[model samples]
Target: MSPLNSTFFINDDIVHPDFFFISGLAGIPHTNYYYIFLGFVYAVTVLGNTFVMFMIYSDHCLHSPKYIVVFNLALSDLCGSTAVIPQVIDTFLFKSHLISFEACLTNMYFVLGFLTMQSFTLTLLSYDRCVAICFPLRYNDLVTHKSILLIIAILWMIAGMAILIAVMFISTLSFCKSTVVNSYFCDHGPIYLMACNDNTPSAVIRWTHPVLILWLPVPFITGTYICIARALLKIAASERLKAMKTCTSHLILVSVFYFPLCFTFALASIIHRNARIINLSLSTVMPPMLNPIIYSLKTEEFTESIKKLYRRTMIHITVRKK
Candidate 1:
């Protein structure tokens, strides 16, 4: 068999077949490590995202446009992580990696859908911060509840349409002889390697997908953030300090999530072999793990809310003991 056509499975698991030979440490086995580490990550991801949803739903203080967008983002993370991580857990625990073709397509759709929505939401957030800082006079008027809702609706619609178009393009191509994916999931990276056709459409997806999802958003966010920073620097020292305190965390997060993501996917078409897969997977996975930590942990309100909930539960338990 051609090297491209040859694939190996992890203990006969029905996995992404292309991942079997990925180099640069991607396909390296962490047999025991992934089980323990991913289990912890899965628990935290599920619980933390759910808690954010709960906080948004329950807290009257979280009803503002900023929090509303955050709530939507939490929901997106919850959905996206859910679609990928459970299969990961099942694979490790049950030794069953046989994902059917239809199931793989469904997982691919949800992942692309939520990841696209996340890009748009992050763009929306940067613009929100820009107007809030650089044009304070119009901030409230520009970012009202109704307006935020409209923007979110548009983002969802756009993301859905984009996923639909891309998946349609992918489905038209045939898997033919090779059907094995090598990654933990049916990530596009692994799928592209196993594909039997000319891969012209896949090449288009590699370029266009990143442009649509990452490149288009990164500039707007980065430029707006820069403008906001410059505008803040011109103000009085105290005001500049306050704005920095409020906005610095988000700027850090935007850089972390967008820059690497944009660079990785933009270059995937050139080097999607196993060696590149490791780096790409790390870049893709880190954003979902870090986003909640950056936004929620930095917010005093969320921290305080969690503390209060803990104390209240403790008190109820104490009383129940009596």
Candidate 2:
């Protein structure tokens, strides 16, 4: 057996057959610590994203197009975290590393799909902000509620179609050899690399899709922000502060979303495999938990709404008790 091929024995008869085995954070000491930490991270991710979505849904003041985009981003975060973290916890804490072929593919689909959705949503949000700041007089005509909804719908459609194409190509491949994935989750690279058949199409899709998703939007968003900054330069100090405040949270989110991803890919060549896996896993969890917190802290409306909701809940509780 090659050094790369790690064998997992099942009973006496089955010896490292073609079964999916997740290799999570190998060579890490004190895995229980990782378990507890990741459990907390997952819990926070779920609760934070859920609360953000609820805030967007319940608060009438937050019915604008920007907040609607935020709500959808929260929804995507919720879904991506739910799809990944539980399986990670199971694999790490419960020693349940074996995943079925069908389940792995399904997980892969949602993970990639939600990630694409988030990228597209962020791009749309940047464009929305650009229009609002650069052409305030025409922003209303350019980005109405109906138009935002249409853009969001198109975003979902495009993301779904991309993933569906990749999934269809993946489905046609054969996994007759080693099915052990050297990562915590069923990532496209790791899983597709395990295929024994021709993976040229899968490789092309996997490589090109991420480039298209990440590279295409990044320059546009950066340029939009640059324009926003230039536009702010001409305004009064107070107005400039207010406009920049509106963008700060989103800029933070973009950093949080992209920085780790970029770093992970850049360091993959030099970092230890175990460290890379650990970094990748944490990257998946950290942004979802942090996004809502950034929004709540930076956005005055979200904070006020949260306070109002708290007050109303307290008053209702007191009345019920009395």
Candidate 3:
């Protein structure tokens, strides 16, 4: 029987529900406050990512290869937040916990896809820093805005396809046992756990998602930083400090984005399911809201760019007042 099409697996006893019940943060106390907080987070995430994208577009100085990755990261952050937060608010905060099967799958696509893209985008930034620091002489030739854009386009496809495949496999699972998805949203793990039929492929894909999204990128980024460290040794002390300082934001971003997620995944077996859900939700919402803030505050170019944009806006407003 084909796993992509569950028709062959179907029997009179097999059952599929039109909708799934999202048991949001069950057994967690005072969850409404948390959702309210997430609403605030959503607002910040939207504003921050939008501002970063606008600055990257308006400032010619930010039109470089590195900011291309920044732009992509902001874009992913925006979309990823939109994918996960609003539905979470609606589902749990407002008590709209019933999600149609199709909507559930759609949620899986975006929540997971943008997540995949977000991770890959960070790795892309590491590459940018890697090339710039380790291959200083050929940095211009090695990395360009055009090449970065192309890679981003390709990555979007890869992340999308990877998640799409997983969602497809999920669609084929017969939810004969239970339709209660114990998550804030349509989590791949929880959803597949509800399946009654052969979930071997689903199980493999479950691991595959983290492997591609987290495990692989972590090591690759580590290696790049190692190379960066080695290269730093040969440079003048003054230049070395400046180069290392430039990497601060990326390092901070990687730590914030990856560490909590890695921790949550690592302790999934030991922690309460509700705790895991909260951690995953926080890991999702926090990074997007923080990414633009970190980049603007940490990176010198972005700080100047924001000041320039602010000055221009104020000048434009003052001129209109006349």
Highest-scoring model, lDDT: 3
Q: Estimate each model's TM-score.
A: 0.81, 0.91, 0.94
Task: Put down candidate 2 lDDT per residue, 1-322, tens digits, no spaces.
Answer: 3424544444333233334787766457887898888789888888898999999899999998889999998998889888888888887688787776668778888988988887788888899889998999998899889999998998899888888888877767766567778888778888777777688999999787768567788888899999999999999999999998889888998998888877888788899888898888777888888888898898888999999999999999999999
Clashing pairs in 3: none
Q: Name model 1 segments beyond 4 Å from true.
A: 1-27, 189-199, 266-275, 304-322
Q: After superposition, how far is residue 117 of candidate 1 from its true place, in Å?
A: 1.7
lDDT of 1 by residue, 1-322 (tens): 3434545333222333332221223345665575566567667767777778788788777788987888787788778777766766675456555565557667778877887787787788888889889999998989999999999999999888877776665555555455656666666555765656566777677567677677798888879978987898789999888877677667766777787776666676686565455555455556667677776777766777777878988999999999
Tens digit of per-residue lDDT, candidate 3, span 234-301: 99999999999999999999999999999999999999888898999999899999999999899999
Model 1, total clashes: 11
Candidate 2 lowest-lDDT run of ten: 9-18
Over the full model, what C-alpha lDDT does candidate 1 score relative to the true structure? 0.70
Off by over 4 Å in 2: 1-18, 318-322
Best by TM-score: 3
User: How much is 306 displaced in model 2, in angstroms?
Assistant: 1.4
Which scores greater on lDDT, model 1 or model 2?
2
